[model samples]
Target: MNYLKPSETLSELFAGLVVVLTVTLAASVLGGGDEAGATTALIGAIGANTAWGIIDASLYVMNATFDRKRQLRFVHVIAASPDEATALDQIRGELDPILESVTKAGDRDQLYRSIYSTLAHGEFPARSGLQRDDIVGAIQMFCIALCATLPAAIPLLLSSHPMQALRISNFLVVGLLFIVGYYWAKYVDVNRWFAGLGLMSLGLILVGVAIALGG
Candidate 1:
């Protein structure tokens, strides 16, 4: 399975919604102009999500570019070899450790395959295949780190009642948080509800403090 599928990115994107929702709710509870607070929360959430997505996309692009360059060097050495078998074998020996290291550093399976296919005449020369579960799991983690703010953005922007809107946004955020946390717990093979709620609560508290401070 591809380690960075659209589904994976989507899951994280949903998780980001949770972050926005939770913050919006907190801001409301702290008291502020309903329309203005909601608008602020909305703006903040959208900004956060965009920033996170750009970061993830940037990492993928940068890493792929770097890996492709390295692969080119390998291809050159292998091509120049007198014996194809020996050259391929030598490259294989060197590539395995490198592949493993890249996997460990981040889920580089998809990027590597792209580079390999481009250079190897459409042949994907991946020595290892990533499990579907691993890719989904990594995406889930990435979302937990990035997407928890989607719900908050709308509330901040549209709520006429600032406090109410903020509260609504907070509740929505908490709910999304629980959803992401539950999925994350399941991915890690842990207690789902407890882990999920625990994470949601922590996020809520942090945002609550920020709202109290007029953030």
Candidate 2:
């Protein structure tokens, strides 16, 4: 049920943050320095990112559903065997990597029986049931994406000068991207400084593209 681990959540948070920041900065730049322009930029960025987040989360849920169906099919195949011994053999053969550490005969037998019963009865056991975690993870992802818009939009919402707001938002986002990249690299056992710079460069590229496209 663990659809997304803590590290994955952090990585997603940073990625979403950078994306929203770039878009908001572009919006601020394109709009003129006025109350109406600032309001438009802030509202546009928030609304766009919110919609994107929902769409992204929905796709994740759909993909997870398909994947779960595939896994159930595999289970059905194993349960279709004629005899207990054959079923166990099939399970061991197909899922050896998963059961390799289960050295105890009793444990293996329990696992085999559990899988066979669940598939044969068309009732998945608690642990093997449809994962609620996927739905929860999707919601969390959506929230992260939506929340990311706020930081970039804050300056635009508060400041009268669109250009000044854009500059501050750009700087804030770049700094955040570097910090996220550094920690992410450390988590993955990579070179932190290089990763930081790399992500920062990527952010800049995205900003350029957004501006060129007249976002």
Candidate 3:
């Protein structure tokens, strides 16, 4: 399914890494860096990520359905409008959020008119319902969220020393945060290194806050 955008994938991974870091750090703070602490952290990370993945998947399905309905509604509204101006207005309202910042009013109007022309001739959907593509996208969302736990979780499992394992896990998650941010910057036109370091710093700050707040 061509459903999961790069931005969405990056967002899930970024959030998941922050959550894992926060959970592990809180466990270490509360459990005193013992075997128990490592065990608690590992379980917490797994459970949190799994739940988050499921939640995101559910939301993906919901959004897919809702978006379909919205599209149909949009088409109907365009078809029902009394004249071209109203239909153009409807299209402008829809396009404004995306084009407002980067484009001039004239450019947006041209784009809106172009879209209006196409939509005027397009047929509205007879019905809206969930499809296979939606399900596939949901599964993709879930997989991305769940897989995000692996880099940190594997290190925790591999080391015999609990403190060392926790340290390694933190390091791995920070690196993952940096990597995600580096890719994220590509879309935003930011300096890659700065974005990477900034995300890592933000992740650490969030974990620290979680620990301080008693997790």
TM-score, every prediction: 0.52, 0.71, 0.87
Per-residue lDDT for 59-167 in model 3, tens only?
9899989999998888889878888999998888887888899999998888888777777877667678999888998998888888878876897888998988888
Could you give candidate 2's per-residue lDDT for residues 4-75 as a string of tens digits?
766756666676766676566655655665667666667776887788788878877887777777676777
**Which regions of candidate 2 fall more than 4 Å away from where they truly are?**
1-3, 81-131, 213-215
Per-candidate clash tally: 23, 0, 0
Candidate 3 runs further than 4 Å off? 100-122
**Candidate 1 per-residue lDDT over residues 1-215, each given as its tens digit:** 45564545545555465446544554455436556556666676767666666566555555555666676567766555565456646555775586865465334545444444454463434532333444454555455445455456565556566776666666776677677667777666789998778777766676666556655
RMSD of each: 9.0, 4.7, 2.4
Predicted structure 2: clash tally: 0
Candidate 2 TM-score to native: 0.71
On a 0 to 100 scale, what is the lDDT of residue 63 in model 3?
93
lDDT of each: 0.58, 0.73, 0.85
What range of 10 consecutive residues in model 2 has the weakest lDDT sum?
121-130
